[model samples]
Target: MNMEFTPDQLQRYHRQMILRELGAAGQQKISDAKVFIAGAGGLGSPAGYYLAAAGIGTLAIADNDLVELSNLQRQIAHNTERIGMLKSDSAQSTFKALNPEVNIISITQRIIAENVAELIRDFDIVVDCTDNFAVRYLLNDACVLMNKPLVSGAVAGFKGHLTTIIPGQGHCFRCIFEEMPPDAEEPSCRQAGVLGAFAGVIGAMQAMEVLKLVTGAGEPLKNTLLIYDGLKSEFRRVNAPRNKDCPVCGDDPYITIPGC
Candidate 1:
């Protein structure tokens, strides 16, 4: 084992460090990684919590929305007292409390195309916990252009799905969903009514994927879409192969711009 980890850190992560796949070396990789999470709502909550507890070196959470009373249903990072606070700020506070060793950066600004590249430029990995399709596409394109790995998760009603996208190695988000669905076609969580615990399930999985990516512990979900059906209590993995014709990560591409 390396002498870099403090006695407290080694004890705190003793259980994980004992795992055959992730020993002290893997833990060191995790401690040196910088992760960017693009939301602080349901999906972001558990994802951030687990990553913080796992001792991610630096975590940056970005969200422009304010916590509403309804958000408490699944947004575990924020409590009733923080109902009106910015989601990013609330998540930072919660993550900091979970692991004071983690460097948490709270960004309360919207992640528009104009600033997406700059926001993620310094990070080693990006986690897509955003709710909408527009920001998803924005993140997908930006990650592809920047050659960053992205752990994407989404939940709606009793269903949730997750996938890991590595720039050149696998399919990008556009390969699976060609274009953003019309707003009317896709109902927001408000209309569909998400199950709180279901979001936690997928969010925790996202964190696991990040850990795998960081430490090279095991195979990640790259080019695979993991689906969860809470009502039926089933989990499915679907093959999501790369599209050679994909605009973002294809041979003859079109979306060469980082955040367009």
Candidate 2:
């Protein structure tokens, strides 16, 4: 990929380019990066929006769900007019309009273990905006095996959390939470009801994490978990250490075992 920026790109991204930490070199890095976003609902919507506007070279969005009336509350990227459209397709349309310079690819199928690795194989980084633990676990394991960076975020009710998982560099999700909790034990937004802007806040943070990872502008959430309580408007950062015996990222990683 050419690292040179065009006149149009320079003008479009002049503001960010002026930042001492993210000058032309950093902007070029962002322009040459490919990002894989896994789901296009509340978190994906805002995260993808910022990345699109920031001129991320290629953004591949994968989501199987179609937009619903309920999604409009926090899915700022989709509208009532796109209610029935596949979320990925809808997100593509919105992103393309926001920044025509970027390449936006949309995948409209459910992400399964069989296809997840191949889907994100070429991307530099993976962002987890998935709503369920099933897909999240699938991505966490796949990214660890593939040695890719994973930026994950989730929100429920008025609380949310995010963390950056750099395979071998920091903690993998499995090291933090050994197993997926039962769905009934952790209610979803539908039952718990998240505030709209709360999702936006966390999603935007995920976007910032992606940009930082791509440009090396700032320290990402590596080895740390950030929790946000919207009701109290507070943010907390806790140390996240990788467990040497973590099943997915341990010395004897389970990913190497076939069908274990």
Candidate 3:
């Protein structure tokens, strides 16, 4: 890896570069990292923003939905002027503007089993920023099958949580939650409004985890789930063990595709 930084690049990331853990070498790794984010909503907005600012070389954001007025409450990457615009397009514009050094790929399509592999195959990291459990499970199984690192985050009302999965190093999402919860059991942001800026807190944490993963700095939440409670202003970490019987990451794997 060349890992050379131009004068402009050096100045752009001077703050992070000065850190002993992530000097120019770490910045170079970040500059070479490719990240695939599955949604451009609340969590994705802030998570993608920090990644862009950190100058991740290639950032591909996938979203089939259009920006809505309701999304403005937490999806900070999109503004009032961009209402009705495709979420991926909106995120592309925002991230590109924030850091022209980043090459942003905006995919305006829903991720399906047929295409999810190719969608995230080339990326170094896969971020689960989608809202619903279906998309969550789809990304989890796909990443496990593909052996890609996954940084998953979720928020409902005033609570949010995140976990990192490095294949064979720790518990996979399926290991912790074997099956998607019943639809009626899932509390969505739409039904239970997320606290404003709370997504920022959680999303920023997600971004930090990504940075750690790329730069090889601090811990990356492997085998542990971190939960945040906005109302109580509390953060907790719980061990998540890999289930030997996990269908996706187990000895006899089962899930070969999405929705299977």
Candidate 4:
């Protein structure tokens, strides 16, 4: 590998390069890695910014929504001035402003099962930042089928969940939830409400996990699920196991198509 950094990139990533766990080699890996973020909203906002700032080689962002004034509370990537723009486009602009060296591919369309695998095949890591269960499940299956590592997260009210899915190594989202809950009214960031800072905290954590994966700096959440209680400032983690009977990545595989 040609491990050369421009003076500007070195200055921008000086802090990361100085860290013992993430020195020049790890920094180089970060600068040569590719990641795909599946949403452009709250969770995706901070995650996208930090990943780009960290010099991830390429980022493929997909979102079919437009920025809304109401999204400002938690969607930090978009500002009032960009309200009429597509969410992915706005986020891409912010990412470019943060680090022009980061290659960004903005897909202003919703990802369906047919396109999910193709969209994910080229990326080394996948980040699940979507807000809905359908999209989440679809992403999980696609990543598993493609055999890529997935950094997943979800937040509602004052709590958030974080986990990484490594095919044949760790359990996937379906391993825990199995199936979507019946429409029994779950509080979402849009409905019940979420603290702006809470999103920042979780999103940053997700970004950290991605960088860790890219740089091989630390063990990822591979076989564990981390839950954050923002209101109480507590973090809890549970060990997860790959289910032998998991529908998508398991022995009897029922989710041949992406769950989306």
Candidate 5:
């Protein structure tokens, strides 16, 4: 891979390039990476921002929802002026303004079983920024089937959890949460009330994980779940070993195809 950098590129990524762990080579890797983010909401906002700012070559954001007044508190990528705009479009505008060098692709469609595979097929990494269990599970299954690395994060109330799934290497999201809970049992951010800044914390960490995976800078949170408690201001790591019987990424995997 070419490690050559134009003067402007070097100047833009000088601080990151200075790190012994991630020199010009790492920057080149990062610049060549294509990351697909599932949602353009709270988590996607910060994750997308940092990835674009870091000079990621291509960023694809998928979201069919429209921005609303209520989203501005946590969905930093969207503003009051962008109300009613497609979330993906709003995110594209924000990320482009932050770093015009980034190639941003906005997919204004809800990710579904029929299209999830095609949506993420070309990306090097997948970031789960979706809010609901259905979409989360869909993304997990798709990534596992495609043998792609996935960085998953979730936030509710004052707490947030994050994990990275590298297909055959470690546990996937399903290993930790075998199946999605019933709708009534699963509380939405609207019902539980999430702290805006708390979402930023987890989203930023997700972005960090992606950078690490791209540049090989530090350990990606393989098989480990990182939890943050905003009220206590503490972080904890839990072991998440792969489930040999996991339906999607197990010895006798049930989900052989992307949408199955």
Candidate 6:
């Protein structure tokens, strides 16, 4: 790839370029990559912000939610002034403000059985910032089917887990857990109650994973899961092996549908 950066881009990303791992070439990789972030809430907030500031070429945010007063506690993308606006709309505005040079695509729709594949087909990476297991599973299955990499993270209260899913290369989300929670609920940062700073920390980690995946700077979080306990300021990594009997990606697949 004949990748070159203009004077303006160099000036804008000088700090990022100074990092030995993220030279002009890596920056160009980021500049040419498209990322699909599946939420505009807490995790998605900082993930999208940093990616935009780092100059990801295009960020497609899919969120069929609206900004509410309660989201202000953890979802840094939306503010009091943005109340009543769609979450995607609020996030797109924030992203543009951070770096107008970054292209933003806002899909104010839910990721459902009918359209998840189309949303991620063109993106270089997909970030699972959504709060529920259903959306997480959907994204996992879609990415696995399409052979795309997915950066997955979730925060409930002061604890969170982050993992990278590379289908056929490593364990998928389904490989870890067989089925969704029996009593599934619409993921609400409101009801679950998350520590604000913990959300920022996890979200920022998610952004770093995205950069690493795009720039090829380090070993991406594949075949393992990182867990954080904000209450004690402790962190740990655990092995995540792909199960041969995994319903979605295993030898004998249970769920099969086109364009999941």
The segments of candidate 2 whose C-alpha lies over 4 angstroms from its true place after superposition are: 1-3, 184-187, 256-260
TM-score of 6: 0.97
lDDT of 5 at 82: 91
TM-score of 2: 0.95
lDDT of 3 by residue, 38-135 (tens): 89999999999999999999999999999999899889999999999999999999999999999999998788877888788899999999887888
TM-score of 4: 0.95
- Compared with the true structure, what per-residue lDDT tens digits does model 4 show for residues 1-260? 56888898788999989999998899989978999999998899999999998989999889999999888998999999999999999999999998998999999868887788778888999999988787888888888887889999989889899999988787998998888767623425666688778988889999999998888888899879999999899999998888888898788998876433
lDDT of each: 0.91, 0.90, 0.90, 0.88, 0.92, 0.90
Candidate 4's error at 68, in angstroms? Answer: 0.5
Q: Write model 2 residue lDDT over 27-120, tens digit each, in one string.
A: 9899889999998989999999999999999999999889999899999889999989999999999999999989999998788877887888
Give the runs in model 4 whose Cα sits over 4 Å from its true position. Answer: 184-187, 258-260
TM-score of 1: 0.96
Judging by lDDT against the true structure, name the best candidate: 5
| Segments of candidate 3 deviating more than 4 angstroms | 184-187, 258-260
Residue 98 deviation, candidate 2, in Å?
A: 0.4
TM-score list, all predictions: 0.96, 0.95, 0.96, 0.95, 0.96, 0.97
lDDT of 1 at 234: 98
Listed per candidate, the RMSD to the true structure in angstroms reads 1.6, 2.1, 1.8, 1.9, 1.5, 1.2
Worst-scoring 10-residue span by lDDT in model 4: 183-192
lDDT of 5 by residue, 11-47 (tens): 9999999999999899999989999999998899999
